[model samples]
Target: MSYFHKLIEIGKENAFVYEYMAVMDSENRKYYLERALELSRNTKIRPKDYKRCSYIAFQSFAWREYDIALEYANFAYDAKPTNDIINLLGCIYHHNEDYDKALSLFHEVNANYEGLNPYVLCNISSCYKKKNSNKMAIRYLEKALDVDKNNKLVYYSIGLIHAATGNKKLAIENFEKSLEIDNNYEEARNALNSIKE
Candidate 1:
């Protein structure tokens, strides 16, 4: 860590240096990452390095810096609106509580791609859940089930929606399914206990 600090002192203007330092400094990850992003603007930065931009954006999102994530996500999106980038942007918007915008981007990925992606379906379901559209949320979760029946997350999400809607029986069923897939899933176990209580 001290080596990284010394490197930063010598190469204070290097975005990559700060970026790497961020990865090693969990306690100050957000600070170093934001500094790297700020310095990136002044540097050449590889003429639209979508991969790098995406990493910074994802890290920002992980740290709950939605605005910063959105900024870098847009940079990647402008370069090439791939499905992954679109999904990341949707996730950022979702975290920012812009459900409508998040839904639009998630739907765009569904429209442009063939076959169902469980992750995208789950994200769409999450946005719908946020909008209080429990029925729509269940519908997408069902689609996710079709994509991967063994996906414990899908069953867990279904359990959540059912629990919210006061369908205790269905909630128990789905939560059981989730636990059956992964008995160590603490969330499923906790949710199941809560429902039982």
Candidate 2:
């Protein structure tokens, strides 16, 4: 088979592994990730050639291996600076508590993409919240809501910002809205319970 054909096979294998990972079976996920790495290595595939580095970084992130996650995320970013990879890199930085880097990447993606993406907006809000910029966080959260009002995560994040700002009523309202959208959202339920009002 040609190199492209081998790459395709590797991609299929990685997809299968990812699907298992989503089901919360860590052992099988690890198995597939390792296998994917092996196949890529045998084919002399560069880390950036086929999103292999990103998948590796995501697995590291899943395992809470922040350092490894950062390394792989960098490789992925270097390979193809797509919005998705940028977002992943931002998330890794956020996990490492490097709020500045996370915020910078999030803004970069948000600025380049003309259409509004609720996830990007919410992630930027999260980075601001981590930096204790409640006002900015709320602003972005509102923007996310404007883009997608039914986004349960945005409502939950808005509730968090309100709670942090001591706006109990608004917090409750947003949390309730989140629960209305996703009845099984434990974070929204917990936030609602935590609020005295």
Candidate 3:
């Protein structure tokens, strides 16, 4: 038996062990995830164990179990609420289509966290775009550019916003920039083609 399997059988109450194993045993993710949750409930899990919960939450997010993801994220928040964890919670909210909650949490991260994380800025831009506030979205994306100009996705997002707003020249320019950075960027290429056609 693998060490992870042994841990599952014997240390079934150790959230930390299961969390570690979950990552290690990627091929059997759902199995380990189930064992991890099972183990988590069986012990007096420490506050530090919340990191384990957060790991599980992230895995759940990757698996697209949004509700479980949020639930585990909240569990982690209850243990130790940091900017990173709160940012994760914000992303979960965004995926759930609770834009208001997502934006609020993102703003919370922005205010509380020391430095600007450009991904968070891009998320803010996404929220604004979802609200059809293209100008506001553009503002945030531009801010993201000031922070990290090399993010191809940022350029692609700007291209999309420009396209939506009928700024064809700017849209094409941003699209070309995005494709320049990533030759295999199919979405940017498709967008550029559609615009040209």
**The best candidate in terms of lDDT:** 1
Tens-digit lDDT track of model 1 for 80-154: 678988999998889889999999999999777654788899999999999999999999999999989999999
Once superposed on the true structure, which residue ranges of model 3 sit more than 4 Å away at CA?
1-45, 113-115
Ten-residue stretch with the least lDDT total in model 2: 14-23
User: What are the runs in model 2 whose C-alpha is more than 4 Å off?
Assistant: 1-48
TM-score, per-candidate, Cα-based: 0.85, 0.75, 0.79
For each candidate in the order shown, give its overall lDDT on alpha carbons. 0.87, 0.77, 0.82
Return whichever of 1 and 3 wins on TM-score. 1
Of the candidates numbered 1 and 2, which has the greater lDDT value? 1
Worst 10 residues of 3 by lDDT: 37-46
Which pairs, if any, clash in model 2? none
Tens-digit lDDT string for candidate 3 (145-169): 8888888899999999999999999
Estimate candidate 2's RMSD in Å.
Answer: 6.4
CA RMSD of all predictions: 2.5, 6.4, 3.1
Candidate 2 lDDT, 1-197, residue by residue in tens: 24434655676554334434433556555554555445544443354453667776777787876765676576667677778888888998898899999999999999977539999998999999988989899899899888998999999998888888888999999999999999999989998998964
Clashes of each: 0, 0, 0
Candidate 3 global lDDT: 0.82
